[model samples]
Target: MSETRTGIETNPFDRDHYDYSSWFFWVEASEEQKAEQLAQQEQFLRVRPDSSIGERCFISPLAAIQVETLTLGRSSYISGHAYLTGTLLTGPNCTINPFCVIRGNIRLGHSVRIGAHTSMLAFNHTITDPDLPVFKQPTSQRGITIGDDVWIGSHVMVLDGITIGDRAVVGAGSIVTKDVPAGAIVAGNPATVRKWRVPELAPPTAASVPSSGPVPSGGPVSSGGPVPSGDPALAEQLRAFDQMVREQAEEVLARSWDAATGRYVDAPGHAPSVRAHCDAIEVAAYLTGDVPSQLSREEHVAWLRGLQDPASGMIAELDASGHPGPRVTDLSVDDAHYHVLCVGYALEVLGSSLPHPIHAVDELGADGVIALLDSLPWRGSPWRSSNVADMLGTAVLWNTRAGTPHSAATAAGLFGWLHTHVDPRTGMWGADDPRSGRLETVNGFYRTARGSFAQFGLPLPHPERVVDTVLAHAQDARYFAADRQNACNVLDVAHPLWLAGRMSDYRQQEIRQVAARLLADALSHWRPGEGFAFAADSGTGRDPLAETPGLRGTEMWLAIVWYLADLLGVSRSLSYRPAGVHRPEPAGSLTSQ
Candidate 1:
């Protein structure tokens, strides 16, 4: 036996011996880093000193192997031999089993349980070009968000850029590659719904079932799947009305292209914009039809062909070049990020419209879009905030469809890049470097800003920290005073406030009060003929007070209205109780009835 550098013996018959010296160096470095990491870990644990813990918790011995950031919730047990590194955020009453590897930026909702040996990683390396080493390329990381009451089975791997919705269950050994919808049970390599949590079924009752009747082809079916004794005239009338709307929508979509181009002299006004045409096609295709209406199909295909920029395989906002064309506004035609976003939207609409599976154009489809997105040097570009966020949102939607590893990595990178730029004190994002000079203010108000960043789905980076930041800013009565007109600054306040409301009850009462006050102020500015108007006192003059129904003011008002309604509904539900209430159950246990 040949003696190795570490005094370990190599197989005597082997011509080449293993490099034990290098291996020893790696081991030594790992040990030294582990010690330093432990010290840092202790520091973070102390920072959250007021956190509560529950009884009968089990933390594995292996969990102590790496001394990195780990936070545990009350009554939560972490099994032995699990490896947790980087920031781990857990809510009350959770369980994590043995031999799991959870690394980097993780947030777990209440009552979440991870079965044995699962891997949850929030960071990935770029590997598009084999010539360049993976490490040399940028590394991207995001927070892994597991919603309330989620049950992840043994040996499952949930990668970055995924959010497991509330009450979702993941089967053992499955790899989740997309957002698992709420109340779903997913399993498989790229996990898909094996079964729905709540199966769709009509209510059953003896009286509801017909004793004996021939099932009518176009009539309502009873509980026993027999035709019910109902007026056929009503059904016929409803069907006719539905058909009329479908036909009208189809006709509108079909004529959009010609109407937009002014090809027919008899047509009134210029042809509709590309976006308008595509939007109409989408509505027509999905609207109550056994087969896609002929007009919907023809218009959809025409829009797809027209949007394609043949020269670069990029989709253009308008047929003409440059921004602010006949229908297209903002962002240049050659803007890689915007083009990719438009392409993703177009493809998604097209994909949903098709009755059967369509083969993706391998070299020039999603892959090409990803390539163009990654190629753009966003590190120091002037349009990083709006443009990068848009591209990232599109990439998330595309990756959810395609499930490509590269797409996932790119999405994570974009989030990681955005996370770093978030103002530590205010939880607001500024323009990224290289483009930093272009932005007049770091976190200034801008129209079309809410959806721009809000499109990045649930479980944002350092969510708890973000929540704290927003609460801190919001509570400073100065920001919420009746005279304050900055409430319309969606990026700096409204969007973050909305996100915080979704996460936790940290400042639930305060947020509700502030939201109510803001709504009252907004209503004061509402004009009778105009849909909604921007406050005259609003410091930013970028948004013009207008009655245009589709303007930014209208969109922001709708979003605010939805947020308030959702919060009120949730509050009302929580207030209800039986005549005499039993012991309170964990919040996570509740699911949609």
Candidate 2:
């Protein structure tokens, strides 16, 4: 059977056939035959009372499923005369293809694709008594677990007590005996890692415009289509969502906006923060059009101008907004980069431009640029390094758009430095911090990639590797829980998937599924009148980070909703698109090499 196999004769995914109350062709069976099949199924259930079958699961009548305990998950099925015995546990979206033999205790995670004629045995016959017949020896249950998003090709035989790691690929006709590491591509008998499906850094794109010339006027902006859903209420729901968001925004402005300071605080009680004001632009732009981004541009611009220092043209981190960035400057590195995003982009959306060149003309020489890149705390804090990248990318881009002095040359050097330093293994910045694992690094990848690569329409250095890594991070059970998943984490994951999806088609269908699920889950974060919470149900700072419902959460999550919906081809239902930082646009000025 093909990896793309839906069903042999019928679409096994048909909801009508998902029910196993009467057995195969149960719908067509006579009343008497249906009753008989029901009794047989009842007897099977009674014998194995530990079975926990999820919704929309299909267990073919032809398949020989004799098990002590079974935990088949939703949207998963057993087909093709499969020989399944003993205890079996599988997460959602798994498939045990036709003619497969799964024996003993087995555990499979979400989206585990077991191809046709594959066999996975989890127990071994005790060989202590060599004199005794092999059949007479007692069996030991050593469970076999195939991790999430794994692909076991046709005719593969996973040996007893084997554990295949997440996002791994087992070639067709291969035998897996040893433990396969995560992100490995293994083949041959007694499978060994042939080549790792690890991260490969994306290459830097060339800046085509002249060094001192002005960037072309119309740089492409990323957006999604009007792909509408069949659901009739979808349009109304989107309109309602918009209205609610508008209501929330209006209420936030009324309550959270500091009339005296001309800045918007996240919430009523919190002190005015730079982040709140920055997020305001997104929320306002999201509601209105992206061209004239904010509600009141003149006031916001005046306020933003006050924050900039006269001598250095730098903006300092005002208050705790729970954002991370390069901590290089008092307006030098960290704040400068962050302002480039908040202040710089906010101005663009407001139908204006940055008041001054971010870094002075010729201030960032080749050596200075390299120093800035190197100075970022890549090892201890990658998130900060990525912030710096965002700042540099934005600075170069903004300059290029204005045709500022040495802007094109600056982009060239910056791209060159990035090309030199990107991690080959992870396709992100720096090595994975053993402290936080891929959580921090993957999140950091978004900040840098979004600004440098996606913002400029440049292909990622290692789009495939980046996609795999980002998708892998989502597998962590605790990190992605709907109740606990935060706005920052989901945005980090989503933007990367959306951006990388534009560059590569590797496992894209799976990516679409993941996005759709995540979009559904993220809906829970909505707070009705208050708008979206940074973290679900964490109204007043869930952990060290205050993720309760606020403007920041609304801005980030609304952006996420657009991205996920767009990826799933249902953005048209939303009736709006992101014109904010989260947008995925191709490079207009820079030519792809």
lDDT of 1 at 153: 98
Clashes, model 2: 12
Full-model lDDT for every candidate = 0.43, 0.64
RMSD of each: 22.2, 24.6
TM-scores of the candidates are 0.39, 0.57
Model 2 / residue 381 / CA error / Å: 1.8
- Summed over model 1, clashes come to 10
Model 2 C-alpha lDDT per residue in residues 1-593, reported as the tens digit of each score: 21112233555454334232212433353455445435655676677654556555556666798775576656677875789876677766688877899987576756788888999987677697979999998665445656667799999988764667556789999998765644568899978767756433111122321111111221122221112242445445556666676555566545656666545777766767776777777676566332123344456655665666544446666644433322323334444557667776565444344555665423675666677788888877888788877777777765554445667667887788888888877788876776566877888888887778777756678877877888888876567877668787888888887776655556766777678678878876786566676777644455634555678888889989877765664555553456446644432233211
**Global fold similarity of model 2 (TM-score):** 0.57
- Clashes (backbone N, CA, C under 3 Å), per candidate, total 10, 12
What's model 2's overall lDDT? 0.64
Model 1 global lDDT (CA atoms, 0 to 1)? 0.43
